[model samples]
Target: MYATLPSPLGTLYIAASDDAILEVDFRDEAMPPCPPASPLLQAACDQLDAYFHGERQRFDLPLAPRGTPFQQEVWQALQSIPCGEHRSYRDIAALIGNPKAMRAVGMANGRNPVAIIIPCHRVIGAGGKLVGYAGGLERKVWLLQHEAGMADH
Candidate 1:
């Protein structure tokens, strides 16, 4: 149900249900217990590796991130943000048909269980400023720039 793998950003802890991904935590927190390798975990690891290497711009794994309905809505909106593009919390709130829920949207974004696959790093502050990310601001910047193909800049 879980596995850890090295990435350009850092060690990544990947968790999954029997057929869907559940979480992808950075090394900042206590590592989750590792379970025996499963097909889903291996697929996640492969997709993640391709993403970091710039060979993948989208993920195809089944994901079942546990969260409130609102949070799930926010995560779904995040997926709509095309790779290499960024949006503001306000934009996401509006996209989800709740234009007044910018703050709530931010909170939901913060709690995203799946990381890169859900693409929460694509959300930014009001004026395109890098802001809160569970994976850390630096990693956020790296991810955004990586998607933009400007990682060498």
Candidate 2:
């Protein structure tokens, strides 16, 4: 099922299957009505709300994004990035024990189905430039700033 969640940045498109929350895409304000909710959907919404209110730093909700084994490995790598800290894509590839897979790491980060909750936003460029958010670079900047408490609004 799919749903639209009103968020501080914008309306987010949330999708869920029976086992886990699967997607959270930013909408462009022409979003349709939200689909009916499931337990997983409700849980994701609650967690996102907690994050927006600055009451949650880490998300522990169920996520089941579909992708290749390499992508899954990269997504799991993203989970270990601590709140308020950032890492380079090269750094994540090293953590996953594949220093040469940096390109693949960035691709997986872009392909991440779940957004802020899984925290692909925490990965920066080697020289610290923000890059490659499927949700848009500006929103990516906004999320990083918001989490770091450096955002204006």
Candidate 3:
């Protein structure tokens, strides 16, 4: 199932299975149709809305992003990065017990299927500079500033 909603960033595309969310696309040009009242899609939209409005800090919905095992590990580690906080690619590599795999960690982060709900925006360059995001750098900055209470929209 899928749904689309307008957000501060832009229109967002949300997809889900019966039991878990699959993906959230910020760059998909076409918005796919979804059932009028799919509980899963509605729930995902609600949570994301709340997040953008500063009413939510962590997501509670079930997520089932597809990736290789290594990427899965990186995504899981990303979840541990608290809202309003940031980590370097090196930090993520260390958390996954592959401290030397910073570049690999970055590759996995770049490939994250789910965007904000998975919180990949929390990762930054080692020197605290904003780096690449599947979503544009400006959107990434907005997300970070939003989490940091620095952005009102």
Q: Could you tally the backbone clashes for each prediction? A: 0, 0, 0
What is the per-residue lDDT of model 1 for residues 1-153, given as tens digits with 9 covering 90 to 100? 689978888789998889899999888555655643998999999989888888888899999999999999999999998888999999999999999999999999999999999999999999888899999999998898898893332
lDDT of 2 by residue, 29-134 (tens): 6887674478777778887888888878888778898899999999999999887789999999999999999999999999999989889999999899888898
Relative to the true structure, how large is the alpha-carbon lDDT of every model?
0.89, 0.87, 0.89
Q: Which stretches of candidate 1 lie over 4 Å from their true place?
A: 29-36, 150-153
Cα lDDT for residue 99, candidate 2: 98
Q: Which pairs of residues clash in candidate 1, taking residues 3 or more apart in a chain or in different chains?
A: none
Q: What lDDT score is found at residue 125 in candidate 1?
A: 92
The TM-score of candidate 2 is: 0.92
Q: Give lDDT for model 2.
A: 0.87
- Determine which window of 10 residues in candidate 3 has minimal summed lDDT: 27-36
**What are the TM-scores, per candidate, against the unseen true structure?**
0.92, 0.92, 0.92
Q: Compute the lDDT of residue 121 as modeled in candidate 2.
A: 94
| Predicted candidate 3 versus true structure: per-residue lDDT over 36-139, tens digit per residue | 25888888898898999999989998999999999999999999998898999999999999999999999999999999988999999978989999899999
Question: Cα lDDT of model 3 overall?
Answer: 0.89
